[model samples]
Target: MMDARHDHPKLVLPPPTYPAVLFVMAWVLDQHLIPPFIDSVSSAPLLGAILVILGLGAAGWAVLRFMRAGTHVEPHKPTLAMVMDGPFRFSRNPIYASFFALFAGVGMIMKLEWTIVFLPILWLCLRLWVIAPEEAFLSSRFGSEYEHYRQKVRRWL
Candidate 1:
């Protein structure tokens, strides 16, 4: 049998770091280079608040599930178990989904148009650099179980 730790996912960086860097860049652009997309949208803050709450809740839940499963939450570390409960039941990448939600929510609340604009780019980077490699590792390590989970759960929802 292969050592799962030795076969951990080859990731560019910690997954959260991608969104953090993108968010900072977006905030800087919004403050200095670009103006708010809307002069004032009364609903933006409310919507942002809702998204932020949901995102944090989902992320926390996923982390707890990881802990219960005794699996390494960090992508670069070895995965000891396949978590299928909690938010994982809905989306394979719930934590990542939460990150996007949190990023967009903060942007909306702050009226940062650049942050919204960078969303697609942020998603593409995550997909290519983070999720893809992780998926490959999971498929290799978990085999059919991971494939079945992948088929059942959408990448993002």
Candidate 2:
């Protein structure tokens, strides 16, 4: 059998690991070093909860589409098909976008200014380390189809 690693995208780390690390680091930094900057908004928690729910919904929709397409949801596995329905129709990287939303929401909820401040870094990491390699793999695997999709859809909305 072919080596499983060879079948997957060349990735620096698992896709979810980036956000997970960001979340923890943001929390730790907030607890130990960084102080909250944004003034307490009375509605912050409600807005944060809404964002979290929306992020979860979007991610769930994307995962469901992948399941229906018979494609592996994990980035470390080879994709069986290109999913273009549901949230994919809007953003090519909906799940990653959802991660950003989740990060923002959690930051707001926990009053972690570090999380909000470091969002750009999270985005950069996803764009370069995660999404870039995944796109490369998809472009190679699906060729014209992926290229067309890339042209049609924004990477993130």
RMSD of each: 1.4, 1.8
User: Candidate 1 residues 23-129, lDDT tens each?
Assistant: 89988887888677655688887888898999999999999999999988987777788999999988999999998889888888888777678889889989999
Q: lDDT of all predictions, in order shown?
A: 0.87, 0.87
Tens digits of per-residue lDDT, candidate 2, 1-157, equal 3356666688989888988898899989988886776556867777888889999999999999999999999987877789999999999999999998899998888877788878999999998999889988889788899999999999998
**All candidates: TM-score:** 0.94, 0.93
lDDT of 2 at 50: 88
Ten-residue segment with the worst summed lDDT in candidate 1? Answer: 1-10
- RMSD over all Cα atoms, model 1: 1.4
What is the lDDT for 43 in model 2?
77
Candidate 1 lDDT score at position 122: 86
- Candidate 2 stretches with Cα past 4 Å from truth are 1-5
